[model samples]
Target: MDPLHDLTSHDLRVRHAMEYEYRRGTNPSVAAININQAYPKAVSERTCQRWWKRWQEEGVDVEDKERPGFQSKVDNEELRDLIEMNPRFSSEEIGEILGVDSSTIRRHLKAIGKKYVSSVWVPHDLTPQQKAKRVNTCKDLLSLQDSDPFIRWMVTGDEKLIYYVNDSKKSEWRSPGQRPVGRPRPDFRQQKVMLSVWWDKSGIIHWELLEVGATISAEVYCQQLTRLREKLKENRKSLVNHWGVNFHQDNAPSHTAKMTQNLLKDFGWKIIPHPPYSPDIAPSDYYLFRSMQHFLDGKKFKNREEVEVAVKEFFGLKEKNWFAEGIEKLPNKWREVIELDGDYIIN
Candidate 1:
């Protein structure tokens, strides 16, 4: 029988198997010519040579190697539909739905110009009216700042919990491939003190570490205001004399209670209107406390007195400009909140 007639009679799989056997004994050129003799659509001699080289390098398998590319399980349209169903679904969750790994989901999502980030934490899910109130308040404050040294006249205060264990101990030296030594987990039951403070653009006017087991109530808050009044007389007499006072505080129940409002009225101080759930606009929260928290990082306190001493030292070390800057940040933040349409001003 003619070799070309026999080649065309059988399939390529049988011929390829014969080629491998031929390559084991004869050269690739001989195998190529032999494969062509029997096959109708003959593979080139170069193709046979390439297959022989691959077999030598990567086992005796004749199948083609897997090529490199994105190789995603879910296509663009499928992913778009999945995201449209729920934009907030995590990559892991989406991966489960699409039968792919989270990393694959992330890669595909990125290819389609999608990203994942943390949701900003805010005190409340603001209503449309509440958002409008924030915008109006910010615009009013900005207007006030343009005409007056509003920051200097402002008396802002807030309470913060200073923990005994503030150290993050986030790093430790370890030999390569060895587990890093970690600090002890923070004790939730550790002793902590609440530091209630009042300040202006000048600096800290007054601060008190609340007594153990004593939380601030309307009565306690009222008494603190009375103390704050005395402190203003002593430390900020000039400011008080010139601008009276513009008290700025969150709408805590204790702060907005009838007694608190009456106390401000009686003292002849003006209560600056603060929007509800708007701590991002508060100087104490967005600026002062942020700085204090940074300073307190990696610090461990033994007792309340140590914490107090540290707190006082931290306050004393700050320059007058630092306090001024903290208050100065407020107007910008207010404007940002307005620009964001009452959303929290996240850094």
Candidate 2:
């Protein structure tokens, strides 16, 4: 390649040398050899000098090498959809499916808005009905928010169990310079015992330590309601004065028990209309208890006592606003679920 192709400051010196030699009228062979190390015969001294001056004026980087090869593996759109499908997949796994290197996957992902967020279970494919339900639920929740807003009189609560087995596998470092090891433990929910957690904007005022887990009995659920009433009474001087005490629970058989229904009617606790088989509508399902489960992951407690403490600590640390935020979402969601004719997804 002719050195003049670059037209750098150094090339200017060569050009000037060639010109001086040309003017001196040296042997054509010697002149050609001298120029051969720098420029071609077709390159005039003036042109070389101009290019050299341009290079000196504007210090530019070497142009990058040509792109090396064809793209391997998945297309950008396909990779994006797959990432959207499941955020938990690492680049290596994505590459394997797409038939490309992990680096290719990483490049594609970075191009989109996806960041290396904590692994998320990007939900499984939902049916058309499922997607519609979810969207409608949001609409209802928003409507509910607009109607009542907040008065502190209306408090919502739900009961759930925090299991003993650490239901989550976590990455830990045993030594330096080694890749962190993740405990790949499947979700081991100990259905034998469950904690009944019910809290409002105030805090976790009532909870039940359930001995039976598989299917909650009507009597057991009624007992939970009874305890919940008693606990709420303890918080306030008179249940009568707090007239807005709305007992919100799902259609667990016990909640719909003949005796329990009578008791709620007698107590004058407003029963928020709860839809059947609707775990999505519950705040505990969406916001509050997810944190509790996450904390319980990768932890082990042999006895009920240790499990109780962990459960207590988990709820105790949550901010008051977090609970309120969940409750606040309910009214609008309820209105929406009702409007969708009972077919809205609540997440």
Candidate 3:
């Protein structure tokens, strides 16, 4: 064998080099020795001999042989129909139904432009009749606004429960691989307060903490409406005289009770026609309460008094324009409800 040998490994380039050496009159042992000298990681003499024989017989190719396996059963039409029937199905669940691997199902899902996502939360599942009612009512309100602009006269109110502690359970910035921080467990028996508030475009008309242990029944609601009327007369006397109170509230049991309806007539306040199951369009639920929830995101209160103070402060901190904007959005929301053909608008 020649002392000056080159390495020829089990690779296309190495095999080609060996072939070149053999064709140039170098012996096989000399070619192998030369290749091993040059490349410490070169294949053994036996591997070179085998590849060299193959090159002579079938030519040189480095790629592996073709692989074989079972074909997929996830057809485009079937997968699309499955997703249309149930958008909430998981990859694993779909795999089980279709007799395929979850990974394969995921691939097909992406190919068909399908994705798993959280469903939006709507306040109510309205019936077709209720939806038609919403459309008709919103159309009526929009028509009225064109001539009267009664949106400015609207005084909407609602009640919400405020707990002693507000924990958003939001994530925080942390080092990689560390466990996420947990929120402190609030006392199961912690104190809570019910806030009943009324407001118009200009600002808050009246808000009160319901007497301890007193839920708002029809009688209590009527009394609150009377107080709201007095507050309106004081703060917005001229507007009230002009519009005579376009009161807007949800169809709660107490609110829709015959006694509550009769009391509004006695107080001479005009009740706005609010369609049932339409809290998404109400200014109190969609606008004011949402803003308040953001303001009270992580606050903690020891008692109802502190919660009241915070609530009052939140109302006071807002400019008159803030209230006006909230009220003005009502017309747009009404239009949206109509545009959606009576479906609940997700904020």
Candidate 4:
């Protein structure tokens, strides 16, 4: 071998110096120190010991031998094209196509910034027209808000299923080697009741816990609206007399039915336009129900009355500002919908 000083490759110099040190019966630690002094971080003592052991057991070679395996070569362009064509393809699937090991495929995919993530489920695969409508509606709402600032007077309502049992898997503190606590799988047939609730910036105005298995129809929804109006008269008399009611509800079949519309007109409430498949912008869906779920977590109710008590407790715990904050998010959500070109707001 050429003199270590004459070796052009830094790796070759390190190997050659290790070999020289082995020939001279120098210890690996000393050999590593000498090599690092010469080349600065050329190799660690452990690496020198490994090379010395290899040379003593097998042989010495200044250059690295080809690693013994089927060398996997991935064509990055081909891999990228395959992923672009079908992002859902698994590492094993791509490996089969590329004639490489799945592990190799995973490493390469990671190198190219590919990550396996579950697809986010959207409310709808909106058509271009639907997207345009969402954008236009949001813009109009923003305009209405700027002119009227009527969100404070707006009353929003929606129905949610209140499960009798709301247990969920949760993490627990345990000894390191101990197995995690297990939870039973969720029961799809668990008893639940429909909770129809209406609220404004002030707080909940009206709420009802329907009987088990009762679903809202157009007639039922219209009756609920009448009840909601009566509640508003009792609780929010000032809002009804001064600002009137700016009602907001999703475009459910019952909510959009002719009877429902006629009832709203008779009550003289201004119906705020809510685009279809837009729970992201709805105060009840995004804010109120989300907080209620947190409150209901791990709770169990034996009867409808127990569930009703829990619901009332949840509502009563929230202050007036909390309800106001929920309604306050509407204009910003509307702006976001327009800014995102009608894409659902992730947060």
Per-model TM values vs. the true structure: 0.61, 0.51, 0.61, 0.63
Ranking by lDDT: 4, 1, 3, 2
What residue pairs are clashing in model 2?
133-344, 133-345, 134-345, 140-332, 140-333, 140-336, 141-332, 141-333, 144-331, 144-332
List the pairs of residues colliding in candidate 4. none
lDDT of each: 0.70, 0.56, 0.70, 0.76
Residue range 121-239, candidate 4, lDDT tens digits: 12234678878898999999999999989997999999887777777535443311123465542332347788999999989999999998687899999999999988999999898
How badly does each model clash, as a count of residue pairs? Answer: 1, 10, 6, 0
Q: Pick the candidate with the highest lDDT.
A: 4
lDDT of 1 at 81: 74
RMSD of 3: 19.4
Q: What tens-digit string does per-residue lDDT give for candidate 3 at 251-303?
A: 77788999998988887777888886676787887788878888887999887
Candidate 2: worst-modelled 10 consecutive residues by lDDT: 171-180
**Candidate scoring better on TM-score of 1 and 4:** 4
**In TM-score terms, which candidate is top?**
4
Native-to-model Cα distance after best TM-score fit, residue 128 in candidate 4, in Å: 1.3
Superposed model 2: Cα runs more than 4 Å off:
1-151, 169-192, 212-215, 238-240, 332-343
